[model samples]
Target: MAVEHNEAVVLRAIKDLVIEPIPVPDLKDNEVLLQMGSVGICGSDIMYWQRGGNSRFRLEAPMIIGHEGSGTVVKVGSKVKTLKIGDRVAIEPGTPCRRCHQCKQGAYNLCPDITFCATPPDHGNICRYYKHAEDFCFKLPDHVTLDEGALMEPLSVAIYACRRGEVTLGSKLLICGAGPVGMLYMMAGKVAGASQVLITDIDDNRLEMAKSCGANHTINVNGRDKLEVASEIEALMGGQPEVTIECSSVDYSYDLAINATRQGGCLVAVGRPSGRTLLPLDVALRKQVDIKGIFRYVNCYPAALEMLSTGKINVKSLITHHFTFNETLRAFETAISRDAKAVKVIIHCDQ
Candidate 1:
C-alpha cells in the first residue's frame, strides 16, 4: 500500500513549530521509502526553532527538522539492491555529489554540493514517512535497537573528532563540555585507547553523568577562570592532554581547550559557534597548538555501527527522554528546559 500523507514536525519560522501533513513523494530509482522509527532531537534543531538559523545555515523557509534518525524500509526503488522492505536502518543524513573532488578524495562530508537533512533548503526525516538515498542508509544488526541506530549520527561525529585529534594508545584527552556530543567524545576517546580522559562542563549533573559513563575525571567549570580551569584539567589528567576536543561553542571553552592542550598537540573544535568569536591566538601560537575543525563526519558510519554492535560503546545512558511522534512539541520543550536535564530526546516516529 503506497502511503499518501506524511505527518511531519516542521519549523514554520523562528520560534514556530507545528505538526502538519506533507506530501510523500514517489521513490526515485536509487531511493527507498522509510517508515521512520526513531528520530533524535539535535541541538541544531532546537536552535533553528528558536533562532531561525545557526552560524553556517539559516531557515529560509518552512522545513522539516530532524537528522539523527532510524527507520524501517517500507519500499525500495528498482536500483536499490542492498536494502529491501522490512529492513531497519540508520540514516546518514548527508548525501554528497559523487563526482565532486571532495567525494572522490573520500572526504565527502566536505563536498560543496552536499545536501544535508534538516539544513536550510533541505527537508529532513522527522516525518512518519520519508525517502532517502539507498546508499546513505545502513542496515542495523538484530541486536541494535532503533534508538541506538539513531545515535549512530552523533557517534559518527565523535569518532571523526577523535580521529582528527589523533586519539591513540596512552594519549591524554580533554573534552570541554559534557553534553551528549561531549560525552560521546569521551567514550570514543577511551575506546581509541586514551589512557586518561577528563571532561568539563558547567552543569554538575552533566559532569556526574560523564563520570558514570567512564570519564577518568569530571570538573564543573561554572564561574571559573579559563586559565585556572586549564590548570585544573592538566593536574587532574597528570599533564596537558595530547588532544583537546571542544564540544561547547562558548568562547571560554575554546580558550580552555587551547590552554589545556600540550605543546604540538591537536585541538579539534567540534562545536558550531553562533558567530565570529575571538580566541587566544597568541597562546595557541606560542604553544604550537594545531587547531582543526570538523564539518560533520566522513566514512565513520561503519565503525560507529560496529562499536554499537560489539557493545564497545554504550549510548543507552545518553537517552534521557522519549516521546511519541505526536508529542514532538512537548519533547522539544523538555529538551530545551534546564530542569529537564535531557541529554538525548528520542521521538518514537513509529507511533
Candidate 2:
C-alpha cells in the first residue's frame, strides 16, 4: 500500500503545528480508508492554531487539525457495501452514535455522542491517510473534483442556514460578514430562490468576492455604526429583510442583524462568537421574529453534493489559495493573516 505510515498536521499547542507521523491502523468493518487529496482550512481550524481554542472547543492536548476534506478510497472494510477501492468521496466529519435520540430523529448533528473531526478529544482528517465510517462518506459525482468535494462541508452549512432561515423564492435576505461562511450563505441564498441577498463586511476584498458569488448588494461597513448600517441595509432592500443570517460573530453585527430583519422574519446565527453577546430582546419579543441557531448540519451533504455536481452552485471561485501538505504551517499562517486576503486556503495532501 502507498500509505505505509500516516503523516498528519498536528497542533501541539497555541500557534504550533508540525507534520508528525503515526502508525496506520487497520480499518474497521464499517470504515473506509482514504488517501486525502484536498483539505480546507476553516475559521475554526485557524482559531485552534492561533488561540489553542475555537470558542466552543479547546485543545486539551495534541490533536490533528482539519475536518473539511475529500479523498480517494484506498481500501474498504468487509462490511462496507456502498463504496469500493479507488472510489472518490467527500467525508462527513461528524460521526454520530446511531443509538442516540437525536440520531433516531434524523438530527444526527445534534447527537450528544457525535465525534466531530478536528474538534477537541477527536482526531481529524488533515493527513495522508484517514479512516471514516462508510455511512458518513458520500461518493462524489463524476463531474465533481476532489477539491470540490472538500468544499461540500462548508456548503452544507450554507444549505442548513438557508433551510433554517426559510429562504425561498422572492425572499429578501441579509447576511452579516462576507467571509467564507457569508459567501456561501449568499450563494446558497440565491440557489434557494432568494430574490435579493445583501451582504456586509469590513473587508472590501471579501465584499467584492460576495458580489462575484451572487450577492445582490455588497456593503462595506468597516467604520459605520451597526445601527446606521442596519438602516442602510433596510433601504437597499426596500425594507427590512425577510431573513437574516448572521455570520460575522461580532456583537454589533448580531445586533444589527436582529434590527434589520422584518417584524415577522427569521434570524439565523451561524458564526461561533468567542463569548456571549447581547441581543435586541425587546425588539425580538415585540416583533415576534424567529430566532434560530444552527450547529453544523444534518442530511445536507447529499443535497450540497448534488448542487455542486449540477452546476447550480459554483464553489471553485471560493478557493483563493493552495498549499502542499508539507507547507501546513505556512498555510495556517496565511489563513490567519488578513493581509493574505485569504478567503479559503486548500492544502493538497501529498499521497
Candidate 3:
C-alpha cells in the first residue's frame, strides 16, 4: 500500500520552507522506508537557498533540498536481508546506473545517469519519511548517533578524496579551508593515521575551530596571496606538506594548495571552483606533483559510520547549531552567511 508523509518543501528561492503532506511510494522488492532523523545543511543547500541554483542544476522548479541525512528503517522489502526495521541507517543520496562502466569499476560517483538528491526535479530526503533502495541504506552500529550517520555523506567524500590523494600514516597534511568538509577531512586524516594536520582559512573563528578538530597549526590567509600563504604554511610545517587538501571553492585556495605541497607531493582537488580561472599547471608539471579530482564519493558510507562508531574520530564538535525541520530555511540562511559562529548546522527532520 502507498504511504503518506510530510516533507519540507523549497518551492522558491529566498522564501520560507513548508511542510506539506505527500504520498510515499510502496516499497519495491529492493527498497526500504526510512524515518529521517538528522540532516546537515551543506554548502550546496545554502547556494540553492540563497540564489536558487548550483552549477548545472537550477531551481527551474520547486525541489526538496537535503542529501546529507540519516534515518531509521521503518519498513523493509523482501530482498533486504542485510537490514531490518528499526535499524538506524545512512541513506546514500545518489543512485547511479549500476550498468554503467563507472559503476562496474567501483567508481559510481562518475556515472552520468546518476540521479542525485537535492538536484533539480530530484526530490531530496527532507521528508518525514522516505523510501530508498535497500542496497543503499547502510545500517549504522549502535554506538553511532543519527547525527554521525548524517555526516557519513560528506565524510564519504573526504575519504574518497584522501584515498585519491594517497594520504596515509605519518603523512604531513595541509588543508585550505575550515568549513564542514575541511574539518571532516582533518578527522579523516587522523583516522588515516596522519601524525599531524594543518589548516588555513580566511575566517579567524573557522581557523580556531580547525585547531580543535586536530590541526597542528593554523594560517590566516586574510591578506596573503597564494604564495605568501604557502610560505607561512611551509614555515609552520618546517617544510612543504606531503598532501594538500583544497576544500574551498575559491581560486586562491586552489593556488595555495598547488604551491604548498612538496616537490613530489599529492594535491587533491576536493572543492568545486566557482569560476573559470587560470592555474599553475606549469609549476606542478615541473615539480612532478600528482593531482587528483573528486566527483562525489563511492562506497564509503559504511567506513565513515565506523569511524564514529569505533571512536576513531570525533564529530560532536562539528554540530554547533541545530534547527527543527520547519526552520530549514533559517538554517540555510545561517549557513550561507559563513557564520563561524555556526560550525555545522544540523536540521532535525522528524521533529
Candidate 4:
C-alpha cells in the first residue's frame, strides 16, 4: 500500500515545535521508503528548536527536525540493489552529490552540495514514513536494536574524530565534555587502544555517567580555571594527552584542550563553538599541536556498525530515556532538562 500522509515534528520558528501533517515522500529510483523505527534527539536538533539555527545552518523555513534515526524499509525503489523490503537500517543523514570533487576524493562529507538532514533547508526523518537514498542507509544486524541503530550517527562521529586525532594503542586521551558525544569519544578512544582516557564536564551527573562507561578518569570542571583544569588533566593521565578531543563548545574547554595537549600532539575540535571563540593560539603554536576540525563524518558507518556487532563498543548504557512518537515534545524536554540527566533520548516512531 502506498502511504499518502505523514505526521512529523516540525519546528515552525524559534522555540516553536509542533506535530503536524506533512506530505508523504515519494521514493526516487535509488531510494527506499522507510517506516521509521527510532529517532534520537541530538544537540543540533535542540539548537534549531531553541535558537532557530546553529553556527553554520539556520532554519529559514519550517522543517522536520531529526537526523539520528533508524527504520525498516517498507518499499524499495527499482534501482536499489543492496536493500529490500523489511530490511532494518541505520540512516547516515547526509547525502552528497556524487559528481562533486570532494565526493570523488572520498571525502564526501566535505562536499559543498551535500544535503544533510535537519540542516537548514533539508527535511529530516523524524516521521512515520521517510524516504532516503539507498547508499546512505546501512543495514542493521539481527542483534542490533533500532535504538542502537539510531545511535550509529553519533557513534560514527566519535569514530571519525578519533581517526582524525590518531588515537592509537597506549595513547593518553583527554576529552573535554561528558555530553553524549564526549562520552562516545571516550569509548571510541578506548576501543582504538588508548591506555587511559580522561573526560571533563561541568555537570557531575554527566561525568558520573562517563565513569560508568569505562572512562579512566572523570573530572568536574565547574568553576575551575582553564589552566588549572589543564594541569589536573595531565596529572590524572600521568602525562600530557597525545590527542585532545574538545567536545564542549565552551571557550574554556577549548583553552583547556589546547593547554593540556602534549607538544606535537593532535587537537581535534568536535564541538561547534558559537560566534568567535578566542583560544590560546600562542600555546597551540609554540607546542606545534596539530589542530583539526571535523564536519560530520566520512566513511565511518561500517566501522561503527562493526564495533556494535562485535560487542567492542557498547552504547546501550548511553540511552537514558525512551518515549513514544506522540510524546516527542516531552522527549525533547527531557533531553534539554538539566534535572533529567538525560544522555540519549530515543523516540519509538514505530508506534
Candidate 5:
C-alpha cells in the first residue's frame, strides 16, 4: 500500500498551516513514489502561506504547499523504466497536457492545461511520500545534494530569463534585484559567456552575494532614485547594456530596465508584482528594445541539472537557512521576512 499515511505541510487558509496526515496516492503505471528529502521555500510559497496567493493564483481550497522539492524514490510503478526505487531526483512541479499544441511545439511551459503543484486544486509534493510521473523527476548526480536538487526550480527561471535575453559571448548585461533569482541570473549570464554583468538591488548583502556569484559590478540602490541608479549602472557597464533582466517587481525596476538597455537590446521581465504596474513604454519603443516576459520555464530542468552536476553553478551558498520538516512554519516565516541576509531557506524533509 506504499506505506500507510503521508504527513504533509498543508495550508488551510491565510496564515494557517498544519501538518496533517493524508493518504499516499496509489501509483500510476508510469509514476514513481518519492520520500521528500528537501524542499526550498520560494517567494510564491511565502505568499501562499501569508495571503493565500502570489498575484495571478488565488487559493480557494486547502492544499499541500510546496513546489520546489527533491526526494528519494521509495517505489516505482510497474511501467516506470527510467527510475527505480532508491533513485534521488528533483521534482518538476508542472505537468502539462502532453497532447496540447504548446507541448508539441516544445513550449510546454505555455500549456494552458498544466497542473502545477501547490497552485490551488493541485496537491504539492511536501509530504513524506508522494507519487509523480517518472518523466517529471530528474535524477540527481552523486555530488548534487537534495537541497541543490530542490533549487533546480528557481535555477530554471534564471536559465529561461537568460535565454530570452539572448545573453551570449561578450554580452554586456544589467540585472535588477539581487534576490535568489537575480543571483542565479548573474551566474547564468556568466555561463552564457557574458563578458560584463552588473546587478543592482536595494540590499547591500544581496549585492555582495551577487558579486560572489559572478556579477562584475554590484550596485546598491538603497537610497538612490531610479534614474540615478540607471545612470550608475550604465557607468558600471561602461556603456548601455546589451541585455537587461528585471528580476525584481519593484515599481522603478521596470523603468530602469527599459532605460538602461541599449538600442535594439532585449529586456526580460521575470518577476510578478502584485498589482498593475506602469512602464516606460515610450523609451523602449524609441530604442526598439525587445521586451519579453518569462513565465516559469520549458525544457530547462535537464540543462539546470547538468550545470549543477558540472559545478558550473554553485547554489550551495544561496542556502542560508535550513529547518526540519517539523519547523516548516518557521522556515516560511524566515523566507517571508525579507531579511536581506537570508538568501534561501530550505526545509529538510528527511527526518
Candidate 6:
C-alpha cells in the first residue's frame, strides 16, 4: 500500500505559515517525490520575510518558499533507476528541459525553460514532500549529512563563481563579505588550489568566522573609508589581488573590489546590490581589468557534492545556527539581529 503524505507549508500570502494535510502529487514517469528534511534559509528567503515580497517575486498568491534544501527519496517513478526509496539526496531546484540546446551542450544551467523549485508563483521546496524530476536530484554519500546535502546548493554557487573567476593553483583571491556565499567561495578557492584567500567584512565576528572556514587573512571594512580599507587589504595580502569576488550587496563594495584588485586583474560580483550604482568603467578600462557578473549558479552541484563527500571541502563550520520549522519567523528575525553569530542558519524539518 502507498504511504499517505501530508505536510506543513509556509505560505507567503497569510503573512504566516500553515500546517495542513496535502495530497501528494503523483510522480511522473521521470519524477520522484522527496521528503525534505533540512533547508537553509537563503538570503532571498529573508528578503521575502523582511519585505513581505522580494520585488516582483512577491507572494501575492500563497507560495511555498525554500530553495537551499535536501531530503530523502520516498518514491521513484517507473523510469527512475539511479535512485530508490530512502536514498538521501540533494534536490536541484531547477529542472531544465533536456531537449534544449543548452542541456545538450552540458550548459543546462543556461536553459531558459527551467522549472525551478521556488521562484514566485511556482511552489518551492519548503513543503514536506516535493516532486522533482529524478535526473535532477543527486544522491549523497552515507558519510555526508543531510545538512551538507542542503549546503550543496550554495556550495554549487561557490563552484560556479570559482570556475567563472578562473581560479587556479597559486592564484591570489580576494572575497568581500563574510556571509555564507563568501565563505563557500573561500572553501572553493582552496579546493581549486588558490595560494591565498583573503576575506573582508564590516563585521569582525563574521571575519573571525571566515578565518575558521579557511580564509588566510581577514579585513574589517567597518569604520574605515573605502581607500583606507582597500589599503589595509593590500597590506594584508601583500599587494592588490589578482582576483576580487564581491559577495556583499552594497554598491560601494563593488568599488572597493575594483580598487583592491591589481591592474589587468578580474573582478566578479557575486552579490546583488539593492539597486544599480555607477560603474567604474574608466578605472576598469584604464587598468585593463575585467569586470564580470554572476547570476545564481550553473552546472556545479555534482562537483560540489563530490567535493563534500571526498573531504576536499567541509562547509559545516558555517552552520552556526539552527531553527525548527515552527521557528521560521524567529529565524528570520535572528538572521537580521546585529548580535546574531551565524554564518549559515539551517532549519530542520524532520525535527
Model 3 per-residue lDDT tens digits across residues 247-347: 88788887888888899999998777767956799978887888887788888887887787888877888998888988876776677665448878889
Which candidate has the top score in lDDT? 1
Candidate 6 lDDT at 268 equals 86
lDDT, candidate 6, 3-30, per-residue tens: 5865655664634655555677898998
- Model 3 residue runs over 4 Å out of place are 1-3, 14-16, 337-340
Error of 3 at 37 (Å): 0.9
Which residue pairs overlap in candidate 4's backbone?
Answer: none
Task: Work out the TM-score per prediction.
Answer: 0.98, 0.98, 0.95, 0.98, 0.97, 0.94
Ordered from best to worst lDDT, the candidate numbers read: 1, 4, 2, 5, 3, 6
Q: Which prediction has more favorable TM-score, 5 or 6?
A: 5
Residues 1-351, model 2: lDDT tens digits: 566988999998897889999778689999999999999999888888888888768899999999999999999999999999888999999999999788999999999999999999898989999999998999997789999999999999999999999999999999998999888888889999999999998888888888888888989887788778888988898988999999889988888888889999999988767777888889887888888999999999999998999999999999988999998888888987879999899999953
Model 3 residue 198 lDDT score: 92
Q: Model 5: how far is 33 from its true place, Å?
A: 0.5
Query: Higher TM-score: candidate 1 or 3?
Result: 1
Candidate 1, residue 23: Cα displacement in angstroms equals: 1.2
Residue 187: error of model 3 in Å?
0.9
Which digits, one per residue and each the tens of the lDDT, describe model 1 over residues 1-351? 678778899999998888999988688999999999999999899899998997779899999999999999999999999999999999999999999899999999999999999999999888999999999999999999999999999999999999999999999999998999999998999999999999988999899999999998988989999899888888888899999999899998998889999999999998867778789999999999999988999999999999999999999999999999999999999999999999999999999
| Off by more than 4 A, model 4 | none
Error of 1 at 225 (Å): 1.8
Clashes per model (N, Cα, C within 3 A): 0, 0, 0, 0, 0, 0
Question: Candidate 5 lDDT, tens digit per residue, 1-351?
Answer: 347778999999999999999888898999998999999988888888888888678889999999999999999999999998889999999999998899999899999999998988898877888888899999998888999999999999889889999999999989989889888898888999899999988888778888888789988877677778778878888898999999888878888889889999999988777688898899999999999988899889999999999999888989999999899888888886765367889898887
Output the TM-score of candidate 2.
0.98
Deviating ranges (above 4 Å) for candidate 1: none
User: What overall lDDT goes with each candidate model?
Assistant: 0.93, 0.90, 0.83, 0.93, 0.89, 0.82
